[model samples]
Target chain A: MQSTITGKAYVLGDNIDTDQIIPAQYLTFNPAVPEEYQMFGKFALSSVPASQAGLPKGHVPFHTKDEFVSDYRIIVGGKNFGCGSSREHAPIALDAAGIEAVVAEFYARIFFRNAVNGGYLVPFESVNRLCDRICTGDDVKIDVENNLLHNLTTGEQWQLKPLGEVAPIIDAGGVFPYAKKVGMLKV
Target chain B: MPAMTMTEKILGRHAGRDSVQPGDNIWVDADILMTHDVCGPGTIGVFHQHFGKNAKVWDREKVVIIPDHYIFTADAMANRNVDTLRKFVAEQNIKYFYDVGTPRYKGVCHIALPEEGHTRPGEVLFGTDSHTCTAGAFGEFATGIGNTDAGFVMGTGKLWVKVPPTMRFVFHGNLPPYLMAKDLILAVIGDIGCDGATYKAMEFDGDGVYALNIEERMTLCNMVIEAGGKNGVIAPDQVTLDYVNARNASGKKYDVVTTDQGATFCYERVYDVTKLEPVIAKPHSPDNRAYVSEVRGTKLDRAYIGSCTGGKMTDFRAAAGILKGRSVKIDTFVVPATSEIAAGLKSEKLNGQSLEDVFLSAGAKIGQPSCAACLGGPSDTFGRLNGPISCISTTNRNFPGRMGHKEAKVFLASPLTVAASALTGVIADPRDCLQ
Candidate 1:
């Protein structure tokens, strides 16, 4: 919820689905329980490369090296990022992995809302070909108030759009807190 | 005032506004809310956390809980998921909880939503499952949301939403016997690619689309999410009215919303389905589409027909028609979407042969009406992808490891194509196998 932020970027390709974010195998534990919820953090994006222990044999567009730092604050992706499944787990996993925000050309509608409403991450819709311009391990700074994303490594900046009504919800930390603040919660 | 699409009309009505334009944000009342075992437990947890344990649901009768995905599996965790739903349903005194092992237990939330009279024309519906958009086939403005959104809906009976721009896909001319609704949708997805319709309402119309039966329409709408559509809809006609009238106990006449003539759209595309051939989405992505003839002779280890998308009685009949008097060379699995469908397969006959008999005689394994292999169940799930085998499935997705194994490749096809491929031990056009 910070107005200004800086982080390392982990770039990914198009259609990075919920399954790839958190595979079905790791979803066995209930998110309702605190102890089980922590399991999500440990296994976030664990199936990026299907060849990993329980994953299938397919190319995952993101980094899968065991030694790679999981704390990439800014994740960049192409069109329709988080395109499959309605699992908030996708955003939960990303947030658990310490992703502060996601910059994508477009996003699946449900995933966009989940990320904002769950207080998992801020989804910033960047200009086209933004993924090509941003490289992995690059230092990126997001100016929330100005709606600008600065690529400090490339010395380029991209404009971000206002989230409209979603901004207040995000500022409230999540849908539940937003509802409480707006008096939507009767109690 | 501008002419409004059905989606705009429905949302506007619910929002208590005269008209709504695309991108307009509004809060609307939800007529029905659905959740399944996979996400239902979490939804319930959030609902209780926000509303308190003693709080009553906004409307008990409007909420539906179905346990479909994790049920029927040997995995203890899967079973526990359903147990959690059962406890929540009991505590809430929910009337529409479809518990596992009950006679009324329908399979696949999408299919069950329509079968149990929950999906009426022009009603806004919401579910935790992504394919909730399938209900939009009944002329409703239904879309999928996450578990947390579903939780909020359960507590307040309302949701804030942005009206999405619509894309109209007009399918003209007569569809060929060799082709199905599945083929038409696949062709559209291929043309538009996976991200083509993101955040857009795909309104399917034209003679070719209206000519299809309710089941075929469901098949067409079920896969809209694959192309990143928020929802897919067909304006209600007599065919839709008849189906709803038969199932609806109240005998009430539901409003049928239609797109005004000359309604503005963000994009418009038309397809002459007569020229369309049987199409399949190749391994890895639903947008990787090609004609069945192009992929013909490609060897496959398995062929499957079942899911909310392809497990309807009509789909089984089509597969049975192709598999009649033939033995499948590859591992073939057939599943009905609901118990009613299962009963129909047992009782209904194709040329005096029951679909169950046709499949069983063709060396096909029949599974109970659950999402058996669609979501890739626990080990021992019938027809689950094991290892690096290639499969042609009627299921919507072909994403890697979707069917169970990461190495296993899946081709998304119609039931007829699947049956034809199972008989030939390779991908083959259904037309080639038809007598």
Candidate 2:
């Protein structure tokens, strides 16, 4: 929905499942309630082992202690991101934590659908494995229109896979709006 | 029209088309939309937000709310979430609300759906849990979806689906005595990595598959999610029909459909069940496969046999056979998948002793029939791993922090293997005990 999203990248390795994204223990916080929904921000990525919390040099927390919003706005991940559960809380937690877009090699289907259907955040697939290339705390900018990711910190750039068939849905801001726009739902 | 796979045929019929192919995205009517305590309140919120605060559900009978996850916990929010389901069911007049602390309560939705006759052949079923694919054992199109997609289906009995190309897995020989459906599926996931079947349909077939009981068939389909499958299916046979007919209380008729001759599969794999050894998924990932013999004697602090994948009667029977008259060396937790199965533990017997008696006599702890520690609920949850302990479990996942503690290690194996390991306080091969 935005022209470009710019922020520091919090990188992670492959198979960062929903359990690691938002542990099942924190799942009792209902996203329907405003306060409980914000709690997702505080605990986003809380279950990821400290050794794998941040890539390359680990032990980086997504959010500071007791803070609802994260300092980082972008996430770089390897294959099968959000693989474990079908809980939409995975994407909602990342968005609540101030992540604007996630650049991963590929994603598990249900997580991709949840992110796009709920309009939670942009899930962009990079042309190559970017987690190995990008370091945590690297300033990055995602140009949505061009499907390009620029590492402002390293002065490097990479092409991202186009949104393909789901672009219209994401463009219209998720399924409900896309349906109305495509005449599947009455306007 | 060209030949169509079972998945295409099912989606085609629902979409009102004579034929469909892989990559075709069309809206199909949903026969059942199941939600649980974990995702139910969130789905209700989305439904009310988009469809108006007072909007009625598309059809009350089509929506099923099962409160299985996070039940029996002292956590306030977990209890409140069930209350949320109760209120929504009352307001929407939903017909199939399995509330906790009630007679109608069931422990897990995937197992409960078929037991209560909600799963049928040639119908489309959706649930909030990934293991909903377990119902595909009945020749149905069942897959897991998120709250938003579930909410959309709640407001309308229809949702968009992309027809997936089927990958046929044929097993050749009969299952050996040391093997279970868990071993067969683990072999599949091992061959193809965790994301191997992403966005594809997995169909199990052959005489080997047909020989399995209904519960064992459910086990085969339950872990397809681990392979990133959109859905898993099997053509309805006499075994499937017998179970559904006995339980179809509503008297709803279902069509028995099969793959057309010459139907093309995106991929195919054949296994000789007799040749395959018992396997275990090592710590940290489901695809980290190792032969039980290769990892034999690996140290473990506990053993668990419970979940939709491993807590059924068939699983318990297999475990009880190994655990009979043997005292466990480590703490072993045995939780059934549903109350009906739980009751079977009391009524069913091995060597003239009840299954519960066998487990208790083996020094294994029996917990209430819920997803006790498969996903590791509240801190006080029964059998939860609170410290960095190593466990051999029959549950599907062993991802870091999957059970409870972030550093806890989990090795996934079949019930027989887990029982053997429980007796030795290490990962032990079931073949030793079976012989």
Candidate 3:
């Protein structure tokens, strides 16, 4: 895992569920297949309502038409981010779409587990709500080592809650590798 | 030693520990790991990826595969997903593979699990679907997991879990005729916002809870995930024992555990069921709740009764009672959660006519037993809200685009409410149509 992640941030409102992150319609594309996995990026967040797609300003697409990857590398979200469904595809979709980190006030349990266990993205809980402060398409830097989110576009910074116990797992890249590292699984 | 709640007890026993508490991450063995068509292929891919292409599962009998979601569709990929499950089950020689197009085929994984006796008391069950918490009704620690965790469990028969502190929700008094478990859970969710129980266990207790039948108890546990609950549990008693004993095909022994006396709870709530009225979760969110009377006469384009949450024998019977003599004023869809429930719709009668007859006479379109249009699978999925419209449904969720079109609105209600609203072409109170 990189200590610093710098990218354009995409802002979204609260309760951005799995359905909106990657609609059920696109779930048929198997993530295990490299081609189908890449297809997830094309339709990621396609079901988020147009008005709620991008915060502050609306109707902003997470990715350009037919593209598999997004220009944004980080996501800024409100409370209850990833609140619905146990679909691991939600995190896989975000990862496939080029998102490296998601900073939210809090997250639904299953989504948080999937994001970390799957090693798809770094799910950071901000000390305070950052969705209102971060604009979509703003340049942001996440200093994971220092637990700080620097909004380069706005020249403001905020503290992120420490990753705590799960940091080692994330650093090892998902549960499987972590298990092997901790001697839970025989290498 | 500190007293442990039912969830803590189950997790501790599975972890081979005498004591476990909230926030303590421990490795626990899984009694059953369920995977359905939607996530099965992905899980299999992961299992094979890390464990080796030819490596065998830790225990073939412990893995149960059910192909339910996106079934009965012509979509090539959807069909192929089930094929993947079939091939893996054959190669692994798993004991509990309910394949599509076979007599053993079940409709929805959550409902089918209890029916097949896989959901036993004092067992830990992990499934790839969020609603797997439904099995907690049988005094167990059951929760949803992602494919990666499930794959790990598949390979090792164990996975790490953080014990969740239990929140006790004791329901007092009998539920009024107009009220169902759906209404009770909706009330709880409304009181505490969606994320209120984000990582906690919700333990349902008191007279009002046990009074409900097994299916209704399952309904109560089913939506705990909606509030971000890790699991929902009710202490197993005669009602649970009777159901489990009758259905335990393997005759597997399971310990019936309960919250110890004076157990600590992080939070507690009490609800008088008799005081509760018919409630509905309005569009976009499950916690956005309203009394049916508050939304009376709200126009609806469709009425659907189905899914693990609503499509059970009890749900269909309640819906049938309201639809027996009346015809629907709007598009109405009735889907049983499993094939057994579908057969019940035919053999089970309402006033001498079968439940299926009641639904058909009421102008409801009956789809094959599956999760048809609950999560809005394919464009061709039956009962899917393809157009922007308002619907009253017995489904668990009302998230945006949950049913079909991104702009479509879904109001989550009980089967009785959905049937009543179907007759009126609007969101009408079930009490108005109940007799």
Candidate 4:
């Protein structure tokens, strides 16, 4: 099974964390806040709008209440996604963001498992030049079946693979669904 | 008659086939299973769904439950997990219950198991947490399981696992006075990279293993997953057997498991701890090993000194001794591993110095038994843009934003190192602060 999403290509530095994905203070509040308002609540993302976009102001963080929330199917980063605590919230926050896949140079074990278990297809992929080419909301086409993520805007494709023994689960729409069927059976 | 490595011997017993070889895939029935609140509730939920009702447990006594993760209850969900396990414990009639607000609060499952005498050497144990392998420090066969496998164990007290290849880490030299097991493991992580031991059984042997206390050994095994090990263990020798004698003073039935020499280690990694200084994993990555001296000047917003990894009576005593004469800088939290440790810290005297009194006098906010900042399940938020921060902690992992914010740096250090950093309010080598 494969899918694709076209949107702006956003670039973040290494060590992007759950706290940055969704700050703890904002997580305590109702997740119903509009999406833009919820982003980087503890710290704002520079000139990103807070009022019009309704993005979180003053570190409020990853507001889920978003209408035009771009379906982020691909993420490219330096190293270590979900490397910190086994929060499970990191994947949850990404799932809520409509992220279908994350591609990183590397990953922390717990995060990798949590991502697969949550039905988020996070592949370990790195490209030399893709970092500078993609921008926020650039409409990328991720060829999941072939393990290729195409930056639609830049005509660039990257490589990645689902972790060992975890690929099938993500294809099945998360652990809950996978557990309901395949995982129940003894291999 | 030939000798086998400790891992090979253990695997040979459970090999269940002709000549159980290293990396041989085999399924061994688990002897014990433990879970904490953070992952416990998830396991229970999944277990209830599959069983639709409580299934027959292979051994009720062998299964244990501890609500150590979300001790203070960050939110309703955390509280709900505690209640979920509590109800099941009562319904299943499981007697080994370590509750909150007790000296037996059981900080982390691994720390609690050995201290409470729940696990014996040589038996394969499964925990619903990555650090569960800490039990291996006592020479017990232990490994961490996901929620599904954990749920399977909760219902049946058994689960499946491939017999992992043996990776022996032989430390032969005398460690420096300041350096300990954590440093050795960190240095190993530095060499092997984080994923060095994936799908392998790490057996720590040699005189170095003999020198470390169970607490120190637990520290070594605690971060095994940081290296992607299927599990990590040590041979049960006198140090291990004696520990069981003291801990299981109840005279409960005991089972012993050990590996023999000639047992091939698929890979052997050795370390010399003689010149080891307190190592810290820079924030956002447990494998980000750096000498404390290299990152010493890193300023910290919050200094935390507790977790299953760091929160022990011994660790607290060490921290307190380091801070005996000095007061903690503003914004430092010294959380005990568990309530019992907290209570014990009150009377624990490190080198003739009363730590509980010393720390209390220094106004260190003593936290209850729970996985405080290490797992980031709760507050004590540290170094941030409001102010650049670096936290030196006794807990495991320093991944970005682990302490408070992503940018907020955290350094994984020994308890003594964390204590010194707490006093200085910056990452500091304990050599200067310790007497």
Candidate of highest DockQ: 3
Candidate 3 per-residue C-alpha lDDT over B1-435 given as tens digits, one digit per residue, 9 for 90 to 100: 799898988899899999999999999999999999999999998899999999899999889998989998999999999999999998999999988889999899999998998999999999999999999999888999999999999999999999999899999999888889999999999998788899999999999998899999999999998898999999999999999999985999999998999999999999989999898999999999999999999999999999999999999999998999999999999999999999999999888999999999888999999999999998999999999999999999989899989899999999999999999998899898886
TM-score per model over all chains: 0.95, 0.99, 0.99, 0.80
Which of candidates 2 and 4 is the stronger one according to DockQ? 2
lDDT of 2 by residue, B1-435 (tens): 999999999999999999999999899999999999999999999998888999999999989888888998999999999999999999989998888888998898888999999999999999998999999999999999999999899988888888998999998888898999999999999899999999999999999999999999999899999999999999999999999999984778899989999999999998889899999999899999999999898999999999999999999999999999889999999999999999999999897999999999999999988888999999998889999999999999988889999899999999999999999998998988972
Q: Model 1 chain A — which ten-residue stretch has the worst lDDT?
A: A52-61
lDDT of 4 by residue, A1-187 (tens): 3665444344444445444454443333322223422342323222222221211122222233453243344555545544433444455555555565666666655566666665545555554534445554556776656666776676766665644556666677655566557544332
True contacts kept of each: 0.54, 0.76, 0.82, 0.05
Which residue pairs clash within candidate 1?
A50-A55, A50-A56, A56-B406, A57-B406
Query: How many clashes in each structure?
Result: 4, 0, 0, 51
Candidate 1 Cα misplacement greater than 4 A, ranges: A50-69, A152-158, B249-253
> Once model 2 is optimally superposed onto the true structure by TM-score, how far is the C-alpha of residue B331 displaced, in angstroms?
0.4
Worst lDDT window (10 residues) for model 4 chain A?
A47-56
How close to the true structure is residue B79 of candidate 3, measured as C-alpha lDDT?
Answer: 92
Q: Is candidate 3 or candidate 4 better by TM-score?
A: 3
Model 1 per-residue lDDT at A172? 96
Docking quality band of candidate 1, CAPRI definitions? medium
